[model samples]
Target: MLSRIGLRSFRAVRNPVRCLTTKTTITDHTTGRVITLTDPNRPEIADYPNPKPELAQNKDPYAKYDDPQNRRNLNDPVNIDDDLYDMWSPDYYQFVSDKTALKHNAIFFSLVFGFGAIIWYFQLNPEKPAMPRSYPFGGLAKELGSGNAEDDEFYRVKPDTTAEQELGFLDGDKDISSAKESYIQQNADFIKA
Candidate 1:
């Protein structure tokens, strides 16, 4: 093991290619400054054999376009009102605003009238009671006025009956029979002939 280790070290020292490193050099033509790099991972700078040729500069690009044609004078009067920006005109804006307002008014009024009509229709065509509202104790005023058993009968509460008759009592009649007959007539289809 000792002889092997010494022989390997000797071979590594003798073989320079195995331990070789990369080197790059750069030189500035004008400043005469030189730069040297010894990093193996760094890229090399390529040098051209010939120098770059210089290009001529043009002072005047319109040198060939020297035509002496008729030109307008700078002091000539120009038309300021070209009518190109007609959208900014007051009359046009007013017309557009009026049209927009009219459309909005039409939609608003239509919605208002439509909702009003719907409400009116519901008011006119109400949901009728499934069973006609029949109060056993004819008038609340009579019962509320006196708790007497004598005033419980029909004739005893004359004032309430008269008031009820005046305010269009059931079927606009005096008795419950007439009201029943009227209800039967109105819903004749539901009852037998």
Candidate 2:
């Protein structure tokens, strides 16, 4: 260990360091004096053996294109009527807006009529009941008013034979038959919807 430490110290003392330094001299013309400065810590800048050549400036590109024969042909200007963009002409802008409105209205009405058709289709149940709903007839009618006891038995009502007929033409009509009563009892809930 003592010999190794001695060798390390000897190697450190034997090596010589190369320091990069620069010196510059400047003159102050006004004061008529000269100054010299040195930078010891700066690293030496690498210099290229061959530097890039400077590029020449380009001339005006438009100067070569001065011939009128080389120019593009211009289109003829459009001569539109004064009313074209106004409300009067056949090719007016309002026509576009009117067409768009018509298209939207058509779509809206089609959707509404389509939905109505669907609802009407659903309302007409294929499994029609045996008895008419209105007094003149019996299976299904708009049951909007308060119905009498003689009316067709629905989802909630119990069939009553003794109930009076309120309207004039319906007064002398006979009671519902046993077959009709049984059918009504069986399909009461199905018809209500």
Error of 2 at 94 (Å): 11
Clashing pairs in 2: 131-138, 131-139, 132-138, 132-139, 133-138, 133-139
Q: Give the TM-score of candidate 2.
A: 0.18
Cα RMSD of all models vs. native, in order, equals 25.6, 25.5
Name the runs in model 2 displaced over 4 angstroms: 1-96, 124-193
Taking the candidates one at a time, how many backbone clashes does each contain?
A: 0, 6
lDDT of each: 0.48, 0.43
Q: What tens-digit string does per-residue lDDT give for candidate 2 at 83-121?
A: 232222343132468789999999999999999899798
Model 2's lDDT to the true fold? 0.43
What RMSD does model 2 have?
25.5
Look at candidate 1 and tell me the lDDT of residue 55. Answer: 17
List, residue by residue over 153-192, the lDDT tens digit for candidate 1.
6343334444445554355446777889899999999999
